[model samples]
Every structure is written in C-alpha cells, then in structure tokens.
Target: MSYPRRRIIQTGGALAGATLAGCISVSDDSSDKNTSDDGSGDGKTAAGTAQLWHGRSKGPKKNLVTNVETFGSETNHSVKLSEISELEKKLENAIPAGKGPHLFQWAHDWIGEYQPAGLLSDQKENLSVDIDSTFTKAAAEAVQFNGEVLGLPWAAETVGLVYNKELVDKPPEMVEEMQSIMDEHHDPSNGKYGLSFPIDPYFISGYAQAFGGFYYDEGNDKLGLTNEKTLKGFRFVRDELAKYIPKDHAYDPQAAVFNEGNAPFAINGPWFLGSVRDSGVDVGVAPLPKPKGGTPKPYTTVKIWYFSKKMNQGGKNATAGRKFAEWHTTNTDILSTLAEEHGFIPVHKDLAGSDELPAATKAYSKSVKMGEPIPTHKHMSSVWDPLKSAFKKVVKGDQDAKPAFKQAEKTIKSNWQ
Candidate 1:
C-alpha cells in the first residue's frame, strides 16, 4: 500500500464562511479548577460523576462501559451513557438549555458546527502533555477546527476490501485481476457476488478516491465530481455494479449479503469484523484494490470526545472533565483496553502497534496508516445528499456517468455559494 502526502488545501470560500460563522475565534476561558477527591489529589474522585452520551446501544454500550471500568477505576467516577441517535436530538436542545453532559462523543464533522456555537472548548490548550501525543495525526487533525484541537480520538476506522478466504485464496491486487477472478467463480444461482460496495454518496466517495476522484477542489473552491478522472471512477463502480453485484442489492443492503456469504468480496470497515467472525466464515482483509494507475484511498472517520465550553458553566466539574479526557486518551492502559474491547485502532501512536489487538484490528490499523482523514469543513455536510443521489443513479443504471456527475456538480455548486 502507498501513503499519499498530506495536502492541506485551504479554499477561500469555505474559510471565509467559517470566519463569518465565528469558528475562527479563540476564546480566553482556559482557567482550570481542581475539585473532587478520588484520593489521587488530582481532583479525580472514586465517586466523581461524569456523564457521556454516545450512539452505541445495548451490547456495544455494555462492552464499552465494561472496558472503561477495567481501564480506569470507575469507582472514582461514574459514567452516564446515552444512545448516539438520541443524544444528537437531545444535544441540540440540551446544550442551549444548560443540560449537556460534561463530555460527549461525536463524529469529527460535528466539531465545525459545535465549535462555532460556543458549545465546545479548544482541547489542545486544555489537555495534558502526556495525553496530547497519544492520538494519531490524522485522527487529531479531523477534530481540529481552524487549527485548534477540540477532541480526543476514542477510536478510528478506515475502509478496506474484505473477502471470503474460501472463495479466493489469493485475492487479486489489481482491478483487472479481480475482474478475471469474478468471471471464473461468480455464480448468480449460488447467490454470490464477486464484489459489493455501498452505492450511497458518502460511502461511494471512497470509491471515487480509490480511482483518483475528489469532490471539492479546496484550492480553487470548485467542485471536481465532473472531472474526467472522477467520472472514470464513477464509471468503474457503475460498471462493476452491473456486471458482478446482484440487481436487488442496493448499497444499504450489500453488507448483509456479504455477511451471509452471498458476496465473496465487499468494501466495508473494521466495524463489521465481529459480525463476519460470528458467521463462522473465514475472512481476509486487504487494502482496497487499486485502479489501473491509482491506489485506493478509503474515506477515514475518527471518533473523538469533545468538552463543551458551555459545560464549564457548571464551574465545578470542568477541571475534572478535562483531567478525565486527558487520562482517557493518553493513558496506555485506557487506550489499549479500548482498542482490545472495541476492535478499533487507538489514536495514540504508542498503542497503534499493540499486538493485543485482534488480528483484523491490527490489519485495520495498518490500513489506517495509509488512509486520509475526511475534510473537516462545515460545508462538507452539504456534499453527501447530491453525491449519494448521483451514485445511486449510476449504479441503478438509470443514467450514464457523465450526466450523473454533471448533475452532482450542479447540486454541489448550488450549495457552495
């Protein structure tokens, strides 16, 4: 796998909009207060209380809470966990109502929105020295808005090609090789697809990157979905969808088919590793196959904990919250334990190489080394709707790649200004 050099593209329009939104201003509320007596004299209490809201429910939540207690003595601080979907709805109302939690976990994209609303604090200046370095550069960069870090990465994942080991002992490295293998073994009657991937815009954009396509030309404030290279990427996915994947399999339903052994190869992330294992199937993971001359670049997303600037209103828990965030991310014991139980790559550089991670997780960590973090601009949220519609049209064979991309570009550009 090849690693692409980091290209920092600062387009004029986006930055100007962010500046207008007041996301570029740095606040002066950096005072730290020590409270609570967990007996460590550090203000952490064996009975300190902190509330956390996340999207994970039931089994995933229980597993995470168990790991949290194992890594840090929760006897010092108790966590109040909430479902991620519910938190999203409640956070909008809660933050303004002064009912938000001390710490919250959210997607990297939320940083841009929350930071400007005065809901989150700048994490870089507030975090401890030792914990600061534990997070990976890409993970850390995602949570940063206008160059100020806002969150500590709890876990991170990138897209990759997962295959059924029994079907293809030696998976092909190139697209052509994969096509040939599919031609030989693909049996529609057996309900097997050579490959499967999401047709939705956010997920399919990764396929475009794999073929050297980009949605935004951040350098020029222009959309590039209509560029020839990008169209070619779309055409590649469209053609593959027609030739190998089943007609009934839409992007959303593809993963279930892959899990059922209906598809020998699929494009997914580390989150599905457990499901595949539980299905009693031997799975092999590899970096996404490269286009003729282009390498596959999966869209990478990072999960981070953000402290609310508004939460500081409580005045008493602010110091302890900062300390807990620092310890949760930087402590080797904490990160490693999370990595082992959650099956996610730890943000800390030291623990990135841990052998304690499951085999699939180690493979994912290796892949993350080659992945690029998604753009963090607030306008980024606007790109998904049009992109998904365009991809679905192409895959469903309703339109040609050229016309589909042109429509996508028009939609994206309409939102840009």
Candidate 2:
C-alpha cells in the first residue's frame, strides 16, 4: 500500500538502533492496491505519501526540495522533502518503528552499514543497468552493496593535487617527480615549500592508495590498512614526503600557504577550489602522485539517494521514488547547476565534456577518474580516528611504523566490539 509522506528527524547521534526488530506492518488497505508487475518495478504499488529525508541545508537541500516537489506534481504522487538533524540515527530508529521515510540522501560510506541493517531497498535489474550506463565508472561501482545497486548517485568527490600555474607549467605525474619539484623549490627559511598537504590519515590515503592499498576490501569485507603496501605507504609518508612539508602545517595552514602563493604545490580536494580562486592565484588541478608500482588514486566519496525498504516493496511509492531518483540524477540542467554551484562533481559523464563545468571541476575530473571509491563497510568507520592518531605519531617521529600500525589496527578491532 502507500504512506502519507512527511519528515522525521532526531537531533542526537545516540538515538540509533539494534537488530532483531519486529517486522514492518503490511497495510491491508485494498482500495489503493495496484500490484500487477506493471513494469514500473516490483509487483506492488504502495498507497501512502513517500517521505524524503536529509540533513543538509542550503544548495544541496534546495536541489532535493525542488526535485521532490517537481516529481510529485508530475506523477500526482505524494512525496515530501524534509530536513532532520542527526538523520543517520533518526533512520536507525524510524525504520524499526515502521515510521521511516521512503527515501533518504546519504554518503557512499553508509551503504555498507545500511544494507546490513536491512534499511535499504535493492534496485530492479533494469534500473541498475541504467545507473551503470549513466553514472561515472567509479560512481556506478560505488553504489553497489554485495552486487546490489543501493542508491542513485548524485555528486562525487576526490582529492587532487593543486599547484600554482605560475610556478609550475606542468604538474608532477609521480611521487619522485613531486620530490624533484620539492628539491628544487622547497626552502622553509624563505617561506616556501614544495608541498603543503597535512600528514593525517585522510591526506596520506592517496599516497597509500598509490602503493596499491585501500582502507577496506569490499570483496573480503576486511580492513586493508595493515597490508604490506599500506605499511610502505606509511613509511614513505613519514620518511620521504614529510621532509618536504614544513612541520605543524595543518589543513588551514596548508591551504593558507597555497593560497598566499608561498606553496608551489598542495594536495587538496574540490572543496578547496573556492579558496584558491578567491586567493586570485592561477591554479592547476592534477591527479595525486603515482608511486613506483601503481598509479595514485584518491579516496572518493559519492553523494546519493537511497531508497528505503518500504519503497522497494513495490507500489505507487516505489514507482514514485524510482521516478524521482531518475529525474533528479538524469536531468542535465539540474546536474550541471549543482556541480557548477557546489564544489562536488556530478556523476553524469556528459557533464565532464560540458564547457559549462566549473573550472575547478573540469580540471579536477582527471583526478576524480584516477580515484577509488571510498570503502563503505561499517568496519571502515573504526579506522579513521585511531589511524589518524597513529599517522600523526609516525609523522612526529615518536613511533615506528610497525607498532603504530598494529596499535591502530587493534584499536579499530576494539571499536568493532
């Protein structure tokens, strides 16, 4: 049957859920029954209003609101877009309470956790095929959970190496090349350095990735940070990379130096594009530096629309949700506007070819293509804080790579408990 759509949000992170909840009550309302495998999708047509939930405000939220309203008017379906704080926790509770929204917006990372919790709806094969053909290769692969397409991708982002075009005619292609650029230009006493990226887990991830490592392996559903390549990446960061970067340069300082034209190169994401532009420095975006055996690839995060279990059950709501997802993702004008106005890149491949793309986005596309989808496994959430701490320790020369890595892995394992 169908639902009456509205928004539900809770403000606290702790208001989440556990497994073993009761089943969703299937409505017995026969008047709205439209179950006939209408090719609209699954053999059921729910009769209620579908709620689209999200936690964003400003541009991203505005895009969703307009799309939701447009979808409703065109199809005569009842869909409401609402904003809620701590949306992830609200979803955790509402799904079990059978008062959940029919759809929601979230990052690619959450798909792993959501799937295990039975919070998402699997797409029809036809829809999955459409997604594959429409979205970027990296983004198309990222939305899947155990071979199932879990969401419709909207925006995609990954870090890139930003360099002053005035200082360097061409960006470096490999780590060694980056080092040479450093060797020739880095001089801390003169208020100049080769690179200005931070030494945290997030920043080092691209370097680690260049060495053939990742935070999690989807195939095995396990952490990969302690692998040989990853360990080498850590050592490289502490040994070779850190020496070029001045000590105590956090993210803000890294951007500041780059913005002030004191830095010839810096590793950053599209989000930093505005700052570079505002600084009035001509900048060029390039892919992360490649390592010896592998190409550099940054960790990519995808923004998407996830269909809830209720909508996947097939019915008017499912049809409406699918319709809305397609409209929001495929409309070229909307996607172009979103990418140009916001820092994130649209997943649509055509946008990459459009002359209308934001300058930063057009330049950053090469880096985005070289990037890997950030892991979505729930276990990955445990790796960040502890690993970043371990990373900082190694950077400071206070710890060895082996023990630091072991401690971080152990801490993550503990977090899994």
Candidate 3:
C-alpha cells in the first residue's frame, strides 16, 4: 500500500506495544479519516493545535521557530510556539497547574526531574520508529527513563580535549603525557599554565567517570562522590594537574587563555569551536586522554523534543505534537542543517558518519561517542553544587579529596529529595 507522505514517520518500523498508560495513540492505517491535521481538537475532538515551548531565541538555533512554522503550514495544523528564557522553572510551575504546552524542547538531563513529577509522557508504546537504529546509542539512551522512552533526540553535545596546534604538536593519548606537557609549560609566576581546565563538576566529571565513579546513580538513587575511585580522580587533578591550571576557572577567561595561545590544551565543548576559529588558532580536537585508572568518559547532553503529559491525553494536539516531533527529529534535511549550520553534532546514525559534516563536528563526534549521558534522575539536581564545592576545596589545596568528597556525598544524600 502507498503510504501517506506525512505518515513516513511510522515507516521506521512497527510500533512497540506495552500495557502502559500515558502513551499517545497511533492508528495502523495512513487514512486521514480519523486523523485531523488542523490542531484544533479539544479532548473530544479529532485534532487540536500543538503548543511547544523552547529556549532558543538567538543564534543559528533560532531557526527552530522557522521550522515549526513550516511544519504548521505543511501539515495544515495550528501550532503555538513560545520562546521562554527560564524554561525549567517555567515548566515546573506551568505543568503542575495544567497550563503547560503539548511539547517542550530541552536537554535529556531534565527527563529525571520532569518524568517523576508526572509532567512527561511515556513515548515508546506508539513511537513507531526504532530509536536504536534512528539515533546514536548515547542519544537514544538519553531519552529513556526507568525503561520508558520519553522524548525524541535531535542533537548531541559533549566536552573534549581542544588543543592549539600552534602550541602543541599533538593531543596527549594518556594522562601521564598530558601531565608532562603541563609540567614543561607551566610557569605560574609569569602567568602561564599548561592547560586551562575548569574545576567545575561538568568539566571534571569525565575524570571521575574514567576512574569508575559517578556523582550519582539515577538508577539506584545512590551517591558515589566519596567512592575510592572518585577520590582517585579528585586527587589526581589536585595533585598532578590543578597547579598548572590558571587561577580563573570561569568559562570566558579559560577560553581566553586557550585562544590567546597561552595554553596548549583546553577541555571544552563544540560551542567553543567558533571562538577558536575567530581567534585564528589552528584547533585540534581529541577525546580526553585515558587516565591511569581508565578511559575518560565525559558527560554528554542530548537535546530533545519531549512530549508533555498534556499531549499524552490523546487527541488532535497529541497526534500533531507526535507527528511534528518525529518528523523534525528524523528528517535528515533538518538534522543536517542543524549540524552543518549550527555546529551541533547530529545524533542521527545516518548523518553522523556522513563525510559532509564539518571537520570539527567529525572530530567531536569521536569524543561524543566516548562519553556517557548525564544522569537524568531528579535527585541529580542536588548533586551538582555539593560536588562543585568539594572540587573547589580539593583544587584550592584547602582539603584533601577524601574529606572533601566525603562531605560532598553527605550533603548530597541529605539534600536529595
């Protein structure tokens, strides 16, 4: 049978069924008889407008709004789109009051927080598309919570070792080599350092991960801050690397140190690629060197389009929202534009290996593959600050890794709600 052009999303394969509530309903046939394209359906109507909220107001990402408009025009649906600044806070407040949109765009890290609050919808039952084959494994895994797929992955990002080729011949393959380079170049008295790594948890989590530790395990709601493996990472950074890091750990200054050719290596994300190019640095990107303990695995964040509980109620809006999300995420053209124009790493398996991707993207993709998804457990929110505090103390030489991480784990457990 010929398929309706709009129903190509279901062509990814057969839909998986489960005895689960909160999943959107999908019909087997491509007939428009039961489906309404105009998003005007109330609870009882065939279709209603699909409302979406996001945080992209500027930069190349703003093109998402244009895409939404195009989707509306093409599908004959009424779409409501809003650009909100404080998306997480607004979503937390609006969803509970029953005033949230049908869909929201955000990173997969929030799945833990929203899914537990009963704000997100289980999407796998009628997803139709095979997530494992459509997106990168990491991206596909990021959208899952407690075995339920909750969103569609669109883009991927993670930190990597960014080096100035002018200053360094090649990126280090092991932490010992990296340390030697730092020692040879470091001259703290004259305001120079070997590297410009930030001490914050986001940047340092890789080291801990390399050593077989995590700040928190969302699956078991367990904290790993004080684990022996984690302490090894903290101690390694403090004793062997932190002294070579510049005093200013803020992003701008750390970037400046690298851009100005004062540092040979910097740990940063794809967002820093443009600035590096603008600064005329011959940039080289590589996966972080394997630490003595294990391979470095940074935290990766996947940008996702999540179906809200509001959309899961099943109606025109739900159908419209699911259709738009599946189409936007799976459309090779849209994903290609996101990667080519915006420097975003495409999570789609088809585009990721394409030779057409920018060189920087190709390099970063290696690092992204080596990384792990940031935990999506709601309690993860309580882990960041405490870990940062412990990290700061360790880096500043005020406290040893054991006590600092001990305190951090204690605080995290106490604050976990």
Candidate 4:
C-alpha cells in the first residue's frame, strides 16, 4: 500500500528552458474528433477536435491525467496533457488568439483575468447538472467571476497545520495553546523550531484566513487589509515568526523545515504529506489554529477545469467540453479513485465521507469544512503582492504591523476599486 514519494521535480528552470526553445506544438487537424462515453447520453461531436492542456508536473496532476485518458476514452473525449510551465505560455498565447484548448486546468483566481477577456464560458447554462449542488459552496464560489460561474472544480487544496506527532502529543486547539506548548518544548539547539512559514503571499493568505480576515470586504467594497482585525492577524503571525521560527527560514522553506524535522509544525497542504512521510517524519495533519477569539479557517484554493469562451462558442466542441467537464468532476468512481491515489480532496460532497481517503487526507478534510475560497474578483492577484510585502516587513522587524497594514490597505483599496 506504499505510494511513491512525491518530489518537487525541480522543473521550474527546465520548463522555462523548454518554453524558450519553443517546445510547444498545436495540432493542425481541426477535423478530428475525440469522444468519451460516460453514459450521460450527451454524445456530441467534438468541435472538429477537443484539446486539453494541463500542468501535470507532479502528484495528482500526473496521476489524474493518466486516469482520465484511460477511463475517459469511453466518454468519446481525448485529452492532451502537457507540463504546466510550457502550457502556461501556450495558453496565454492561444487564449488571446481564440485557439486555446477546449478546457484548461488552472487556479481559481485565474477566472478573474480570463472572464474579462471573454475566454471562459458561463457554466450556468451549458452544464448538464446544477453546478452548485455538485461541489462544495466554497468550490463553486472560487470558480465564479462577479456573478458568473466560470469553471468546474476538478480538485481542491487548502492550508492546514502539519505537526510531528512525536513533538506534539496532543494538537492544541487554539493558537495561544500551541504557542505555550512550543515555548516549553522548542529546542533551538537541535534545530527544531516550533513553527515555520514563508513570508510568501500564499502563506500570508492562509494566515489571514485563520485570523478570520479576508482580502476584500465584498459588503463595503473596501480593502480589508487595514482593519483592526486584519492587523491583529498580521501581528499574531509576526510575533510567532520572531519567537518560534529560525532567522534563516522564510515562508517558502517552511514546509522544508518540517520535512527535515527542523520544525514541529507548519501551515501547508496535502501535497506535502507524501514528502514529509518520505523524509521519515511521522506527521499529523490538523486544521490551522485560530486566534484567541477567532475560528480556525484556511484559505482554500480550488483546482478547476475551465472552458474557453471561444471553445464554447466554437459550436459542437463547446457542447463536448461541457459534457466532459461535468462528467469528469461528477463521476463518483473517478473522483474517489483520484482522491485516494493522488491525496487530494474530492470535490463531490458524497465522496467527502468515503472510506477510501487516507488518514492524512481525512484530517485535511476537516480544514476543508471550514475553508474559505479565494475571492473571484478581477483584482485579487494584484492585491496579494502588497499584502505579502507588508507582512514580510512586519515579520522581519523592519516595520510595525499597523504601519505595514496601512500601506497595504492603500495599495489594495486602489486596485480593488
């Protein structure tokens, strides 16, 4: 029952190199057809042919694509999977030219950019079933832009506290409780930190969520970065960064510290579970700790399959894309198999309580219960940079939380409006 240890595959540089060498090719035959038989009776001609692009660098993407190709053949559809880095550039170029793949796997936030460019379809009409009922409400919210559902969730990821069972006999229920335990047990002499987190934007996003802060206040249409509650959250993390973490470690290396057994706790995702196990660490996953008065919540990001608006308008191909996406995400057998093998949560709620999930994944599922989706606004990506920079300054002791947040609030407000 042992699985292959997952590695990061140091392909960032290689992918860039391949992109520079123009290692992308588009099939010129627009008359070929790829079909799948999912028994939904939605056999429509794939517009000439349907093309799919994915960044299957590691873990779930690699395995999921393999399963899709093997099982999806019965549904009369074909998928062309490629490395993410190369496909990113290919998608950017093809999307503008209205020649992109029928469907693409991307982060939830990308809906903002693609929706404005008219590159994504409205899921309300084309989908065979009710989109909202198929997945978690959070998953549905993440794929929407303004009021339109732009994509169907393929998989979901969220941050959670991964702790070494040997270090923490019982996981603390509150942030203060964890801090007290760390203060008493943390052994700096042995290179063991109580916690580790990167100063990167993604980590900041999760911290904000745990503190019950959101990037934008949709109700008031104002930036939430400078609110008193938000500043409190930033200060909480900064204090922990100073007291419990090593000076050399930054946010990106947070998981590495835990994997190397240099830290007992880290805020990360299921993707790191296999790596930590491979590193010989007995890791236990739990929901991110909440502040003294706040509830534990993680910023959940959904990995979704979005159809290009152009593809949807391309006639028969659009119908096929819709059918393919619906079947792929809604199929219980496919979702259960992928979740069990790939270590990701199934989007379908029915599979949430399935016995097929691993213990670690089941632990993460609790966090998913309290997860908050990334905002589906047009300016969300632009706001994170300033917020992350502000957090880093506070964490590094270069600035106080109040001032750093004020600056970030200004930046976020400007872009948000």
Poorest stretch of ten by lDDT in candidate 1: 8-17
lDDT of each: 0.62, 0.69, 0.72, 0.65
Taking all chains together, each candidate's TM-score versus the true structure is: 0.80, 0.70, 0.77, 0.81
TM-score: model 1 vs. ground truth? 0.80
User: Which lDDT tens digits does candidate 3 get at residues 1-417?
Assistant: 111011101001111221112212232222322455343455433444677776552333346767876776666454567655546666777777666777888777777767777888897987778999899887888888878888899988777888888777888899899888878778878777798876778777777677787777767888888888878877777776677788877666777788788888888876566667667888887778887758777877888899887766665667777878888988888888767654679989999778999766776777777877777666777778888888888888888888988888888778753
Give candidate 2's whole-model lDDT.
0.69
Model 1 residue 201 CA deviation in Å? 2.7
* CA error at residue 44 for candidate 2, angstroms: 19
Per-residue lDDT tens digits for candidate 1, residues 202-298, read 4455557666678765556667788888887778777754478766545445766777877778777665565566677788777666668777665
Rank ordering of all candidates by lDDT, starting from the highest: 3, 2, 4, 1
| Total clashes in model 3, counting residue pairs 3 or more apart in sequence or in different chains | 8
The per-candidate count of clashes, in order, stands at: 9, 15, 8, 18
